[model samples]
Target: MRMAAGTEDRERGADLAEAAPIIRANGLSVYYGTKQVLSDVTLDFPSNKVTAIIGPSGCGKSTLLRCFNRMNDLIPNFNMTGQILFDGVDLYGPGVDSTEIRYQVGMVFQRPNPFPKSIFDNVAFGPKINGYEGKLDELVEQSLRRAALWEEVKDRLKSSALALSGGQQQRLCIARALAVHPRVILMDEPCSALDPFATLAIEELMRELSEDYSIIIVTHNMQQAARASDYTAFLMGNEERIGELIEFGETRQITTNPEDERTEAYITGRFG
Candidate 1:
C-alpha cells in the first residue's frame, strides 16, 4: 500500500535531514560585473544522491553549478557573496586552492567534449598531471567501468576519443572526471546534445553513479529531472530576482505536489 503524499513527504524530509549534507550553500549571491545572476540562495545537497536543478532559460543554473567548484573564478569580473561549504569547509575562504577543489569536484559539460587524443590518453590526463603514483592503466579501466563505457570501448582504447559516437564521448568525459577520484560530479545539460536512446543511457549511468558519487545536474527537460534525480530544486527569476531557488524537496514531492503555486504553474505548463 502507498502512503499519503503528506506523510511520504514528511518522512523523506526527516530522513534527508538526518544525513549530513555533503555540500551547503548559504546566502550565495553571484554577479558578473554589476549584474546579479543569483541572489541569496541557500540549499543543502544530500550526500551520495542525485540533485537536479530545473529552471527556464537564463536562470543561472549553470552559474550556480560552477560556483561549487570555483569555475566562475576563471571568468573576469566574476564576484560572489556568501559561502559555499564543501565537507564543512568554506570553498571561497582564504588560502584555499581552486585547482585542488576542482580535482575533488569534477564537471561534465553539455556537449560531448572529448580530447583529440586516444581514449586511453583522455582518461589518464588528469591523473598524470596530478602526479598519480598508482597504476595508471588500472585507474583508467576502473573509471571507464564506473561510467559504463569500458565494455563498449575496451577493444578500441587506442582509438581517438573523437571517433566515438556522441553518447560514448560523453561517457568518456564522465570517465575522465572520475579518473581523478572526485567526490562530486556536476553536469550541465549533459543530455541536451543526444538522441532519446543516448539520453536514456546517460540517465541510467547517473543512477548507478549516485551510489558512489554525489551527482548534481542542470537540465531544461522536466521529464529528465523527474526521472533521474532523487531531489529537485525549482529555480525562477525575473527582472528583480535573477536566480532564486523557489522550492526544493524530494523529486516526488516537488514534481507531484509542490507547495509553491509558482512551482505548480511551471511544472504544469501554465507558464514558464
Candidate 2:
C-alpha cells in the first residue's frame, strides 16, 4: 500500500531512532550522456545526525547530494540508474513525483541565490507553492528564528533580498529552506563562498538545526567538516577511486585516529 508523506516521514523517523537509515542508496550510478561521472556507489544516511561528505574536486560529492533530491534532473542529458530510498520508498519508482521528493528533501547550494524579490517573499515562496494555508507570517518568523536570521533581518522583511550582505543573504537562503520544513536537508558546499564569520554562523546554524532536521553536507574543508559534523564520509574521486569510503564513524575518530591511510593523509594535510 502506498503511504502518505506525513506517515512515511514518521515511520522513517521511528526506524532511524531505532538505528536504521532514513535514506539508503545502493549501486548508485550516474551518467551525463554516457560520460559516467559517478560509478557504482552505495551509502546510507541515518537521521538527525550531521553527516558530512568530504572529497576532492570532481569526486562526485555534489553529484551524490543532487541524487537525494533528484536535483540532477535539472542538468541536461543527466541520467541515473539506482535506488535512493526515503522512508522505505524508492524515489526513483516509476510513478513517484520528483517535485514531491524536492519538497521533502530541500537543498542549499554553494552560492546563496536569493530571489530579487523581498525577503518575506523569498521565505514564503516554497510554502505558497505547496499550498501552505496556515498563518504564513508566523511560519516565516518561526523559520527565520530557527535559522538564526530573524534577529538580523526581522526589521527588513520588506526589503529586496539583494540588498542584504552576502552573509545575510546566505542566512536568508537557509531561512527559506527551513521554512519549507523538509525532513532531510541537502547542503552542497554551503560555505564555500562565505567569509569566515559567515561560515562560522552557518556552521552554528547547522549544528542547531540537526536537533530537528537531518542534515547532509558536502564540504571540501576538512576542519569545517570535523568541527560541524557528528559523522563524516571521506570520498576520493578517481577512476580507481570508486569513491573510496575512508571512514564512516564519529567525527572525532574520522578526524583523529582514522583507520584508513588515505583518510590520515587527507586530514594530516598529505593531499586533498
Each prediction's TM-score versus the true structure: 0.95, 0.90
| Candidate 1 structure quality by residue, lDDT tens digits, 1-272 | 11122233555667677768888888889999999999888888888999999888788899999999999999999999989999899999999999999999999999999889999999999999999999999999999999999999999999999999999999999999999999999999999999999999999999999999999999999999999999988888967769988888888888889888878998888887
Which digits, one per residue and each the tens of the lDDT, describe model 2 over residues 145-239?
98888998889999999998888888888889888889899999899899999999999999999988889999999989999998777777666
Task: Estimate every model's Cα lDDT from 0 to 1.
Answer: 0.91, 0.82
Residue pairs clashing in model 1 are none
| Per-prediction backbone clash count | 0, 0
Pairs of residues at least 3 apart in sequence or in different chains that clash in candidate 2:
none
